[model samples]
Every structure is written in C-alpha cells, then in structure tokens.
Target chain A: MPTIWVYAEIDNGKLDPSSLELATKARELGDVEAVVLGPGATEAAARLGEYGAEIVYASDDQVYADYVAQPHVHALTELIGENAPDMILFAMNYDSRDIAGRLSARLGSTLMSNVLEIESVERAKTAIIGGTIIVDVALEGAPKILLARAKSFVAEPLEGGEATVVPVETTVPEEAKRAKRVERHEEAATGPKLEDAPVVLSGGRGLQGPDNFKHLEDLASAIGNTAVGATRAVVDAGWVPYSYQIGQTGKTVKPSVYIAFGVSGATQHIVGMKGAKRIIAINKDEEAPIFQISDLGVVGDALKIIPQLIEEVKSRKG
Target chain B: MNIAVCVKHIPDPNVPPQMDGKYLKREGIQGVLDPGDEFGVEAGLLLKEAHGGEVTLVSMGPAAAQEAIRRGLSMGADKGVLVTDDTLKGADALVTARVLAAAIKKAGQFDLVVAGVESTDGYTGTMPGSLAELLDLPQVTFAKTIEVTDGTVKVNRQTAEGYHVVECSLPALLTVTAGVNEPRYASFKGIMAAKKKPVETWSVADLGLAGEDVAIKQDVAGQTPAEERKAGEVITDDGSAAKRIADFLQEAKVI
Candidate 1:
C-alpha cells in the first residue's frame, strides 16, 4: 500500500478535528499514518488513532512545545527522510502550510495548496485564479505534499481500530529555534466557531448599521448552535470585525446550513461560503445574484422578515 | 534594516478572463500587480519609514512583471529586481520559491523579506514559507502587524482561532495578509519619480540556476471552469417567506 503521512497539529492536548478529517481521508488513498507535533502530541495520538490512522508518530519535544514553524519543518524533514512516505497530507492551517511549504523547498518537491479533491497519488485538484477555475494538477515527485482545504472531508471514526503509537526522536537545530511566540491574544469567543458551527447566520450591508447586527445575534442565539458571519461590504463599512467577514478575502466556511441575511452575494462573498450543504439567502432584491446559487431564496426586507423568523424558530424550539 | 518585498503581476482581477481552452488567456487582459501583494509593498514601506532603510522590490515572472516593480517604485520603494527566463513559464510554487530565494540572496543581505500570503492568480499561499526555508530564515506567516526593533521582528499573526504575537530575530521573512494596512495609492509625483528609479533585470543565469534547477514540478493534466451552483428553489415573498424557509430547513434536515 502507498504510505500516506499526515501532519497533525496539536494544541492543549487535543488533536485538531480538521487533522482527524485529513487522516480519515488519507485512509482511502493508502495506509495512513499521523505525525503529531508539539507539547500534547503524545496525548493526541489516541484520538488520532480512532480516526483510522495506522501508525502515530507522536513528538512531545520541548523544542516544539510552543508555536514556531522552523522546528516543525526540521522535524518533518527528518521524518520524510526516514520514512520515505509516498505522500504527506497537511490540514490547511497556519502551521501546516508553514511547515509543508518549507519542507517542500528543502526537499525540492511539489507542494499543492488548497486542494479541494484528490484524484489519485499523482494527481490532485485545487481552485486557482481567485476561485474562477479548477485545475487538475499532476505532481511529479516523491513524498508529494498536499494541503487539503479545511472541511473538505468529514471526520469519520473507525471504531475498534487502534493505531500503534511511536514516539518521534529528532533534534531541532539551534537556528530553527530563533523565532519565538511571545503571546497569543485569543478572541473572547462564546458561541460556536464559524467553521465548526453547522448553521451560520451572516449579515450584509442591508442590515443598515452595526447595531442592526443584534438581530442576527438574536436569531443565532435562538438557533442555539449558529455562528454569525458578515459580508465584505459590511466589514469594509466597519460594521463587523475582520474575523466575522466571510468572502474571498475572509474566512472560507462550509457549514451544513448557511443563512445569508441582506447579502447580495457578490462572487467574492459566494466563493467563501458556497460549499454550504444548504444555502438560504434572504434578500430584498429578487434580482440579486445570491438567489442564483441559493437552495432556498427568500425575497423580502430582512428587517421585516428576520424578527418573525426568530419568533418562528423560538416557538418551534419551545 | 534592508527589506525585500516580493510582488507579482497578474491578470486584472476585475475582468473575468476569456479562457484559452484549458488555461487563462492572457494576451489582451491588462496585467496589474496582484492586489494582495500591495499590502507587502505597504508593509515594506512602513518598515522602511520606521527603521530608516531601503526597500527593494523583487519579482519572478515574464518581462511584463516590471510593471509591478514600477508600481512598487511608485509606492515609495527604493529599487527593484526582476528575475525572468523562458524556462520558468510553468514553474510551480516550490520552483518559484527557490528562484526567489536565489534572487533575494543574489540581491545581497536583507534584514527582512515580505510577501503576500498568496498570489491572487495562483493562490498557493505557500511560497513565502518555502522561500524562508530555502534561505534558512525564520518566517512569520499571515502577520497582521509587524514591528522591527533591536535586530528582531515582532508580528501579530492571524490564525483560525484568533491571533498570536510572534517574535523573531532579524534576517527573517514575513508574509502579510490583506487588511493588515491601508496601501497607499501611487501619487503623480511618485509615479514620475519611479521613472528615475533603478530596476535591474536578471535571468536564471544571474541567480546561478539552470533550466532543470527551476523546472516546474507539477503538470496540469486538465482544467475545468469552476462548478456553478444552480438556483435550486426560488420563491417570491408571498408574506410567508419565513414559514417557507422554516419548512425548507426542516425538509433539508439541517435544523
């Protein structure tokens, strides 16, 4: 079987769910193994094993105990040299992209980023030119690096299967330790994460003002498990934080249910959330292009419609 | 306190391109500097203002890429370098990174190398990290705010979770995201001054690279226009849009 190695990022003793999804997808391609890095790699192995990893290379080294790119790149470079895996999959994240890109340069190999689908060991597909075209690319090299887009695969557990965990033994060079993480300013997030939330409620310029976003917050709270998002127009207008922006320049989200309120759905906005399983757009303009891609298009004033929708949803929940 | 900013020339993002069968047709499309790279230019200029150093713009593309260098010059960059050769026609991300690393090294010592998180056209988002590794420099990717002090650089990096403050010694690399700073428009005076600014053109040979060293590693097997989503169910407002939406949500089983 072709050996596939997945780079799993661990934080606070937990394996990122997106990495598990990558591991789950790797099973179909070949015999899958996971290489977890950082302080909690050892603790994360068991969880990764449950997601169909055949082997887990857990590195609980102090050199990588913090968030830095060079050390991880050095560790992965050594692992690729030792294992000679045919392909390595990295979950699309900051650290994974950093390490994968660096390792590809070190090894003179091909690194494919934002891959949407994998056709085979040799060929993969990614969106290019601002999501206007899909290109099937064949990478010619050993240890092909694929950075799978986040949420491209579902994390399916393989019950009753356990992976053999092996501690990774590698030394981080002195030069690799130059960069240090000083502090992390974590956002005071209380609700579901935009990417993790199954239901997303996003507002646009039609919401009128920043204060009007409170209605979206009410609807989201009423829905219980929804994350609030915003369009570029609203974000540019200073109605929302950059973190709340969803578009070509913002967060790319693929929720199970996406509700767009007052969003005219520019191509920039649509490219970010088009992967929603069910897209529901609420727009006052019936001629809006958002209705073209929406699974359910509701033509009405959001101000008049959202309050009633919230009441209806609350009553249903009651 | 010398900095190098990597910029790219791409087809204008505003105009939807006419496809050349399986690839983007570039013959008639106006090529502008990649929008994302403007942030890099702006950051580099800001760094220069703070640290009192020169910002050298670098790019790897066809001869037309000089347009991007001129634009950067017009935006207050000091000098520019263009690396172009026929062999680099289909270069992939890794190859591009290697060539850029070489060009940066050839341009001499730089305290920092700044680039866009990804090019608007390719969107690989990996070249800066690759370039850093090739040059053996510390990298801070997706930085929102960058500060250079006492031979070190600090940045606030954007992440899926939130943000992190990262610090690295000088002679490092940083890839910036959009919204990091407001890019300045090229002024008439600046545009005129750009004509006098020196832009050096180099080939693969100048960087001690050959056709094989920078050959593209990925082959395009085929291409397809992006899949268009169809309007599945469109209903006008009959004073029951909310109820209809609720029922549709229930039927879709997403509630």
Candidate 2:
C-alpha cells in the first residue's frame, strides 16, 4: 500500500495552513506523513505529528535555511528519490510550486498545479476531470505531484502529539550564496483570508489611485470579518499587489458572498471570483462586465457606494 | 538578456459570448492576444531592450494564433515561431510545457523564458512553473519587478500579504504579474514589418511530442452560458438608493 506524503511549508517552526490542509486531505489517502523543511526540524516534526503527519522529515542545512528556488527544488527531489511514495501533495505556495516542478521531472511522474477541488480517490487508477477546477488530472505512473489550491480546502486543528522525528542535512555547492533574507512586508489586515472569508470585498480602477483603497479597507473592516480583493485593472494600475487581484491572474477565491465596488469586472477579473456563492456589483457603468455576472447589480459611482455601503453595515450591526 | 516569451491568442472575454455547441458563435465577439500574454511579451521586450539581446515570441495554437505571433513581432521581438497543429487544442499545462520544452531545447538560444501567469481560458496560472520544471531551471512566478544584469537577477514576487524581493542567478524562468509592465500597442510600422518576419511552425511530429504527450486529458466537457444578471430597478431617489443598499446587504447575507 502506498502512503501519502505532504511537503509541509513552515516559517520559523510553525506549520503553514496549506500543509495542514494537505495533511487533512491526505487522511483520505491512507497513512499520512509530512516532510518539513526548516531550522527547527525536530520541533516542527512534532508539530506536524499533531497536525496529521505520522512521520516528519526535517532539515536545518544551509541550503534549506533561506528560501531559494534551486536549493528547495534539489531538496524535494532528493527526498522523493529516497522515499518513492505513491503520491506527493504540496500546498500551492510559492516554494511548493517552484519545487514540485523539479520533483515531478526528476521522478517522471505527473504534476497538477493549483488544483481547486479534489472529487475522489478510491481506485488508484480512477480518472479525474473538470469541475470548476483548472483541469482534471490523474497521475498515471509512479509518484504523483499535486499542488492543491490551499484556500479552497478548509483547515482544522488536529490531535496534538509528538511524532517520530527524522533529521537530515541538505547539501549545497560552494558557489551558492544561500538565498539571503532581504525584505518582507505584511498586509495591514488580510481579514480571514479571501478564500476562507464568508464575504469578499474587491475594488477596481473606479476606486482611483492606490491610496484610495483606504476606503475599501475601512469597508472591509466594517463588514467585520470579510477579506479584501482587487480587480486586475486596479492591480495593474499599481494600486494594489497582484496577490490581491481577484481575477484570472490572481487568487481564484470563491467566498460565500462576493461584493464588487467600483469594479468594471473584466472577463479576466470575473473568471477569478465568478465561483463565489453570491455576487454583488456596484459600478457606474450599467453595462460593465461585473453586471453580467452579478446576482445583484447596482449602477452608481463606487466612491459614493463605498461610503453608503459602509454606513449601512454599521447601522444594521448597531 | 536573450529572452523567450510564449504567447496565446484568446477569445475576447469582454465580448459576451460562449461556446454554442462545438464552434464559437463569434458572431459579434472579437479576439485578441491575451492581455496577460501581452504583459509577458512586454516584459520580454523590456528585458531585451535593457540587456541588449533578442526577444523571440513562441505561439503554440491554431494557425489563427499567428496574429499573436505578429503582435509579438510588432512589440519588438527579433523573431517569431508558431507551433501549429489542431491536436494541440485544449493542451493541459503539463503537455503544453513539454512541447514548448522540446522546441526550446531545439532552438538552444534562450537565456530566459517568460510566459503569462495564466491564459484567459485555461487560467491555471501554472505554465511558468511547469516549464521551468521541464527545463530544470530556477523560476520566479508572479513577478512584480525583475531586474537582470550580466549573470545575476533580482525579482520581486507578489504574495497574498505584501511583497518579497529575491536575488538569483541568470537562466531562470519568470511568469510575470500583470502590473509589472504596461503592454504597448503594435505600431503601424511594426505591423508592416511583422508581415515579413519568419514564424516557424512545428507539428507534433516535428517537435517530437506525441499527441498523447501534449493533448489535454479531458475535454472542455462543456461551457454553460454565464448566468444572466439584471441591473435591477434603479434607485429613483437618494433615499431609495440607501434603502436598496440596506436591503441589498440583508439579501446578500453580508450583514
């Protein structure tokens, strides 16, 4: 019987949510274990056992310390070679994505990136196909690579217990600089995470400059537990980061309720969030593409809509 | 600075339309090089302009996609290559990357490969990462800023929260973010020059990639019309607008 292996992501020593979700999903596959890469290898392995990993493979070598594409890819490839697990699951994070490709090639197995939804996995040979997912993929031969969209799957804490910890040192050549720590910035309030949030509030070029998003931020805060997203146009306008974009180019978030204010809803933008449960659009253009998919469309200026929407939320909650 | 930018032609999403049965009713809808791919081409141009090298545009789709190649040429690419074969339709990112990889290895002139984060339709956002894997090259996807000099390169990758800048070596792969560069329109002179540019077409046989190697495992299944939405009654009065706003939130389950 083949066991499921999860390539866990960790910062400092805490496990990333994606790795947790992967372990939870892997539960269905059979015995689920984790492969953690970080400084606190032993402690991280124990944490992984609590989360769901029956086994923890950790490292603290120079190559694995700082985040660099080459070293990480090399480490994952070597791990796969030794274990030869049937399936490998990675959270669709930057590092996971960059490494999976290398591992897939080195193993000659199939690689499916950014899988939004996973339907089933009974017989190892059952075929999987399309359903709001990027594509239906089946890993035919040996070890398989699956990069699950982290946000689509919900995360829950697992039973706490220290697991068997296995330590290893990753090797790097003399020429490598060992990717140095440069700069890191965090969003003011990402809210509950756009994917997990019940409500997603996104803005577009109608919101104007990058600073104008202050109103959006307030609106998101007023909505209390909602996440903030952005249209491709706004992201392209440099008003927001591409990660915040709610279009084809950004995160394809499907919240319970998606609200678009001052968004023109380009097709590319709509593709990202069209899966939301309920969509509401507020734009001056009655003919905007956002209106095409919005369940409730309000044609008006977004600047005005934001203030009014924010006030109404406060009033109702009061 | 020698760069390779992969381009794909997509249906104009701005136009209201869907696949009616098998063929596109394109009755009124227009088509254009995908906006994301335009960014890829533009990013390649910027790299070439800065590092003083050539930008090559590679298109793998139907012959109609030649327009995408011409557009890339118009964008200042030194050359163009179109890999056309009907069987290449609906190619999953994995197979598409393999096909491209074979062609890339054959050409053997690229130092950097750039592609849109995702196509307007497939929308997987995995090509750059996948291609880099096939070629065993280091990759930086969703790049906000990429500066290369000599053999060293620095890139800013966008994450959910803020931004992180990374420095790496050359011969890397990058899937650019949309805001990284504004795509310039093709000039009239460029368009004229594009007509004379050479675009190499490679088939599955020529590329040494079998249909099974590159064809999508699944068919589109089908495309349903986007649910129709109405612009509802206008708020005739200011007070009425406020009322609708309140009722809207209640109905939308926001409150």
Candidate 3:
C-alpha cells in the first residue's frame, strides 16, 4: 500500500478533530502516518495513532506557535524530504493553507484546495460552481498535497496498538522567523459552533436591518442546538461578525437542518450550506435562488414570519 | 515606497457557472474584477495615499482580463502589468504565482505586495502564500487591518477565534480579507483617466519561463452534476406559513 502522511495541528494542548478525520480516511488509501507540531504534539500523537496513524512524527516546539507558518513549513519540508510519502493530507484552515502553499512552492509542486473527498490515492473529489458541480480531479504528482475541507470525513478511532513515535528535529532558519505573531485575541462566542450545530438559523439582507437578527436568535433558542449564521451581504454590511458569515470564504456547515431567514441564496452563500441535510428558506421573493435547493420554501416577509415561527417552535416544545 | 497588488478577473459571481464537458465554460460569460480583490486594491490605494508611492496592479489571465486591471487602475493604481498567454490558460496556483513573481520583478522594485485572500471563482486561498514563498518574503494572510511604519508592517490578521497582531519587515506580502476597507467606485474622471494609464502585456517567454514550466498539475478526470436537492412544497404566507414550516420541521425530525 502507498504511504499517506497527514499534517496534524495542535492548539492549546488539543488536537484538531479534522486531523483525526483525515487520518481515518487515509487508512483506506494507504498506510497512515501523521506529523504533528505545536505545544501538545507529544500528547496528541497517541490519539492520532488511535485514528489509524501507524507512525506519529511529533515535536513540541514553541517555534511552531510563536511565529506564523514559516517555521512549520521548514520542519515539514525537511520531514517530507527525508521520508517521501505518496500523498499528504491537510485540513483546510488558516494556518494549514499557509503552510501547504509555502511547502508546495518550496517543493515546486501543486496543491489542491477545497477537496471534499478522496476516491483513491490517484483521484479526489471537489466541488466547483458553488457546490453545484462535483468533479473528480486526478492527482498528478507523487507526494500530492491535498487540502481537504473540514468535516469532509467521519473521524472514527480504531482499536489498535500504539504507533511508533518518531521525533522531528529541525532548526528554523532566521529568514523564516520574519513574521512574528505578537498577540492573540479570541472572540468569545456562546452556543454551539456553526459547523457542529445540529440545526442552523441564518439571516440575510432581507431581514431588513441588523437589529432584526434578534428574531433569529429567538428562533435558535426555541430550537435547541441551533447556531446563528449570516449571509456575506449582511456580514459585509457590518450587521454581524465575520464568524457568523457562511460562504466560500467563511465556514462550511453541514448541519442536519439549515433554516435561512430572508436569504436570497447567492451562489457564495449556497456553497457553504448546501451540504445540510435539510434546508428551509424564507423570502418574500418567490423567485429567490435559495428556493432552488431548499427542502421547504416559504414565500413571505421574514420579518413578519420569524416572530410567528419562534412562537410556534416555543409553544410546540412546551 | 513601491507597492504591487495582485488582482484577478473572473467570471461574474452573479452568473451561475456553466460546464463544458469536464471544464468550466468561459467562452461567453460576463467577466468582472473579482469582488474579493477590490479590498486588496483599496488597501493598496490607501497605502499609496499614506506613504506616497505608486501602486502597480499585476494580473495573469486572457486578454479580456485587462478589464480587471483597468478597474484597478481606475481605483488609483498608477500602472498595470498583465501576463497573458495561451499557455497560462489552465495554470494552477503555484504556476500563477511563479508567473506573477516574475512579472512583479520585471515591473520594478516593490517594498510591499498586496492581494486578496483568495479569488472568488477559485477560492483556493493559496495564491498570496505561494507567491510570498516564491518571492522569499515575509507573509501574512487574512488581514483585517494593516499599518505600515518605517521598515515594518503591522497587521490585524483575522482568525477563526478572533485576530492576531502580526508584524513583518518591509519587502513582505499580505493578503486582505473582505471588509478590510470600503472599496470606492470608479468616478467618471478616474474612469477616463484609467484609459491613459500604462498597462504592459507580457508573455511566458517575456518573463523568461517556458510553457512546460507552468503546466497544470491537477486535471479534471470526470465531472458529474452534484446530487440535486429535490424542491419540496412551497407555501405563501397568509399568516399560516410559520405553522406549516413548524410542521415540516417536525416531520423532518430536526427540531
């Protein structure tokens, strides 16, 4: 079997679940190995092994976290040079994209992003045209670098023995330390994350104004485990934070049910939420593009219907 | 200070994409400057206004892509450098970066490079990083706010949780996210002035690269329509829409 390497990430002593998900999926294509770096790499290696990583290359160096992606790129370039794997899987994220892009440039190889599935070592599936078309892309080169969208695969830990732990040692060149991260600010958010929520309630420009988002919050409260999302229009209008934006640039969600209030279904917004198992959109325009893919389409003013929907949901639950 | 901003001309996002066999059909669709790149243009203009430097717009695409650069020039960029050739038709991100890096070098000496975090059409979000790597420059991505001082650049980099305050020296690259700045529409005067702006067109050979050097690495083996979500019942509100939706939610077992 071919050997596949997963670039795992660790933050604040916690391993990103997407790494485990990729590791699990990689087992089917080839032997699975993982390279983890950051503060908790040593601690996260065992969990990676449980998720089908036969070998775990780990380093607990602060350099990976202290600087931007260059240090990690330095380490990964060395690791890949020493032990060339047939393919490398990266979970699409801010840092992963940075590292993968740089690594691809350094290696003079091509990197494919927004991959949704791996059919085999040679072929992968990606969505284009705002998730309306699914295409199988041929992985052309050895050590193919693939950045998979998060939540693309189920992360299931296997009952297996401990993996052989390998140490990754490399000195970060001074040039790689040019960009320094001085401070981190975490925006405090309550409720389930949009990606993990079972139900999602989204607002769009048709909601009329920013203050109207309260109706969405109320409705989300009535429906347990629901997170609020916003279209790119409203988010760009400063009606909501970037975290609440759902689209090509923002987070991709595959909730069990996605309820959009006043969303006109721009192609950008649809790509982020089309993966939801059930979609219900409410808009005054019967011709709204959102209705094209919605499981239940409601033609009406969202401002008029949201309060009633919130009340109906609350009363039914009671 | 000299600044270079990478911009892209793409199929208008408002128009639904059409497929020609396994590839996207770009023959007869309306094209526009990628919406995301507008923020980069605005950022470069702001930097130029603050630091007293010329902003050079750089792009790679077919001849029609000049429209994208024209839009940028109309936004206050001083000049434009476009690398357009038939071989660059399906160039991947790395190849595009190599071409852009060569073009940027040929354009002039630049202390800073600005770009959108990703193109709206491709949405790969890797161009700036790859370009920075090939150019051997310090890099920052997802910048919501940028400040330049003597020989140093500071940025408020957006992250999943919040933001990071990052610092890099001059001769660096940074990618700006949407909402970083309000992009101004081209005034009539600016639109007319853009006609006089110098836009140099370069081929792959002009940049000292061969067609084989930029060959695409990924291929679309096959394409199939995504499984369509069947349209369900539609109900117009006459004061009962909410109740029907609640019932539908109950039936779906998701509430």
Candidate 4:
C-alpha cells in the first residue's frame, strides 16, 4: 500500500475536524500517517491516531503559533525530504494553503487545490466552473500535494491505540520568522456555526437592505438548528460579517437544507452551497440562474414572503 | 517605497465559461482584468501616492493580457511587464509563481509586492504564497488593511473568526481582500496617459526557463457533469405561498 501523510491542524487543544476528515479518508487510500504542529500537537496526535493515523510526527512548538506559515513549512519540508511519502493531504484553510503553496514551490512539485474526492493516489476529482462540471485529474509527480476542500469527507474515529509519536526537529531560519501575528481578534458569534449547522438561511441584495437581516435571524431562530448566511454581494455591502459569507472565497456549506432569500445565485455563490442536500431559492426575477439547480424555486418579493413564512412555521409548531 | 503588484487577466466572470476538452476555451471569450486584483492595484497606487514611489504591474497571460496591464496603468500605475509564451499555456500555480518571481526580479528591486487574495477565474489562491516562497519574502495573505512605515508593513489579516494583526519587514508580499479599499475608476486623462506608459513583454525563454522547467505536472483525465439537482417544484408567490412552503417543509420533515 502507498503511504499517505495528512497535514493535521489543531484548534483549541483538539484536532481540527477537517484534519480528522482527511485522516479518515486517507486511511481508505493507504497507510495513514500524520504531521501535526503547534501548541496542542501531543494531544492532537492521540486523536489523529484514533482517526486512522498510525504514526504521528508532532512538534509542540509555540513558534508555529507565534509566527505565520513559514515555520511549519520549514519543518514539513525537512520531514518530507527525510521520508518521502507518496502523497500528502491538506485541509483547505488559511495556514494549510500557505504551507502547501510554499512546500510545492520548494519541492518543485505540482499541487492541486479545492479537491473534492480522492479517486486513488494517482487520481483526484475536483469541481470547476462553479460546481457545474467535475474533472478527474491525474496526479503526475511523486509526493503528490492535494488540498482537500472542507466537508468533503465524513470523519469517523476507529477503535485504535495510541500512535507512535515522533518529534519533528528543524532549525527554523530567522527569515522564516519574519511575519509575526501580534494579536487575534475573534468576532463575537452566537448560535451554531454556519458550516456545522444542519439548515442555513442565506440572504442577498434582494433582501432589500441590511436591516432586513433581522428577519432571517428570526426565521433561523424559529428553525432551531438553522444558521444565517449571506452572499458575497451582501457581505461586500457590509450587511453581514465575512464569517457569514458563503461562496467560493467564503465558507463552503453542505447543510441538509439551504434556503436562499433574494440570492440571484452567482456562480461563485452556487459553488459553495451546491452540495446542499436540498436548495430552495426565493427571488423576484424568474430568470435568476439559481433556479436552475434549486429543488424548489419561488418567484416573488422576499420581503413579503418572509414574514408570512415565519408566521406559518411558528403557527404549525404551536 | 517601490511596489510590485501581481495582476491577472481572466475571462470575464459575467460570461458563461465554455470547456474545450480538458481546458477552458479562451480565444472567443471576452477578457478583463480580474476584479479581485483591482483592490491590489488600488492599494499599491494609494501607497505610492503617499510614499512617493512607483507602482509596477506584473502579469502572465496571452498577448491580450496587455489589456489588463493597460487597465492597471490607466488607474495611475507607472508601467507593466507581461510574460507571454506558448510554453506557459497550461502552467500550474507553481510554474506561474516561478515565472512571476523571475519577471519581478527583472523588473527591479521592490520593497513590497501586492496581489489579490485569489483570482476570479482559477481561484486557486496559491500564487502569491508560492511566489513569496520562491522569492524568499515574508507573506501576509488576506489583508484587509495595510500600513507601511520605516521599512515595516503592518496588516490586518482576515481569518475565519475575525482578523489578526500581523507585522513583517520590508521586501515582503501581501494578498489584499476585497474589503481593503475602494478601487478607483480610470479617469479620461489617466486613460490617455496610460497609452504613453511603456509596457515590456517577455517570453519564458527571456526569463531563463526551458519547456521542461515549466512542464505541466498534472493532466485532466476526463470531465463529467456534476450530478444535477433536479428542479422539483416552482411557483409564483401569491397570498398562500407561505402555506404551501410550510406544507412542503413538513413533508420533507425539515421543520
């Protein structure tokens, strides 16, 4: 079997769910190994093993957290040079993309991003043109670098023992420590996260104005497990925070149900939510492209329909 | 402060894309400067206006890519350098970065490099990071705000939760988000002045790269249509539209 290494990420003393998802998928492909860095590497390594990572290369270095991506890149480059795995899978996020890009440049290897599925170690599948077409791509070089999109695979833990934790040692050059992250400002958020929510209610310019988002919030509250989302246009208009934006550049959500209000369904926005199990779009324009993929499309003013829908839902529950 | 801005000329996003076998058909489609890169151009121009230096646009695409460069020039940039060659037809992100690094080196010594968070067409969002690595420069991606003083660059880097205050020294690279600043339209006078700005076009050979050096590392085995989500029911909203939707939701067991 080919060897596959998963670049694992840690969040709040736990392994990031996306990393675990990649590790779970990697187990099906080959012998699963992992490389995790930062403050919680030791703890995360144990969890990674439960998700099918047999051997974990870990470094609990504070420098990985203090600086940007270079330290991790330096350490990973050295590790890959020492033990060349057939393929390395990365989660599509800020630090992963940063390290993957640098590693691909340093190794002179091809890197594929936004991968949706791994057909095999030699081939992968990706969506292009706003998720309208799926392309099967051949992985040409050894040590294939693939950045898998979030929510592509389900993470399942196996009944496994502790992995062999190997410490990663590399001298981080002074040049690599140039970019320093001084402070982090986490936006105050409540309710469920947009990505993890089962149902999502999204808005766009057709919502009329920013103040109308309160209606969406009210509906989400009534829906119980629903989260609010917005299109790039609405986010760019400052109607919502960047965290609430769902599209190509924003978060990709595969909720069980996605209900869009006034979203004209730009290709960028469609790509993010196309994987949703059911899509319901409401727009005034009958010709909006969103209707093409929507399971149920409504043509009318969102402003008039929202209040009535909210009432209807509340009355039925009562 | 001398600034270099990496830009891209892509097929207009407003137009539906057409596929030619494994590749996108580019010859017939209209091309425009990537909208995302406008923020980068605007950021560079704003810095040059304050710091009193030049803003140079660097790009790699077909000969038609000059239009993108000219658009940047018309926005008050100084000049442009475009690397266009047949060898770079299907160049991946790494190859593109290598070529841009070479062309940037040829352009001159720059204290800062700027680009968008991602391109509209490919949207890989990896070029700037790869280029920064190849050039041995510190990189700050997803910058919402940038400030420069005394050879240090400070940025508000956007993240999933919020933003991070990041600092790096000179000779660095940054990818600016759309929220960074408002991009200005080209004034008539600026458009006329752009015609006089010198633009240098170079080939891959001029950048000291052979065909093998930039060989495509991946191939498209085949392309198939994504599983279509069939349209189920459509209705124009009347007074009872909400009732109908609520019933549908109950049937779907989502409510």
Q: lDDT per model, in order?
A: 0.84, 0.69, 0.87, 0.88
lDDT of model 1, residue B69: 95
After TM-score superposition, what is the CA distance of residue A294 in candidate 2 from its true location, in Å? Answer: 4.0
TM-score of each prediction: 0.91, 0.85, 0.97, 0.97
Tell me how much of the true interface, by contacts, candidate 1 captures.
0.75
Interface RMSD of each: 3.1, 5.0, 1.6, 1.5
Better of 1 and 2 by DockQ: 1
| lDDT for residue B105 in candidate 3, whole number 0-100 | 90
Which stretches of model 2 miss by more than 4 angstroms?
A12-14, A121-139, A157-162, A173-181, A187-199, A221-227, A241-243, A247-257, A266-278, A287-295, A314-318, B16-30, B208-239, B248-255
Q: Fraction of reference contacts reproduced per prediction?
A: 0.75, 0.31, 0.76, 0.72
Query: Per-residue alpha-carbon lDDT of model 2 for A108-145, expressed as tens digits?
Result: 55666556555443122111111221323344555667
Q: Which residue segments of model 3 deviate by more than 4 Å?
A: none
Ranking by TM-score: 4, 3, 1, 2
lDDT of 3 by residue, B133-225 (tens): 888998978888899999899998877667789999999998998878999999999999999999999999999997556878888888888
**Which DockQ values do the candidates obtain, in the order shown?**
0.59, 0.36, 0.73, 0.73
Chain B TM, per prediction: 0.91, 0.87, 0.95, 0.96
lDDT of 1 by residue, A66-132 (tens): 6578888888888788889999998767777788888888888888887888877898988765555
Q: What tens digits encode model 3's per-residue C-alpha lDDT throughout A254-316?
A: 998898999998776886788889899999999998998988899999999988988998888
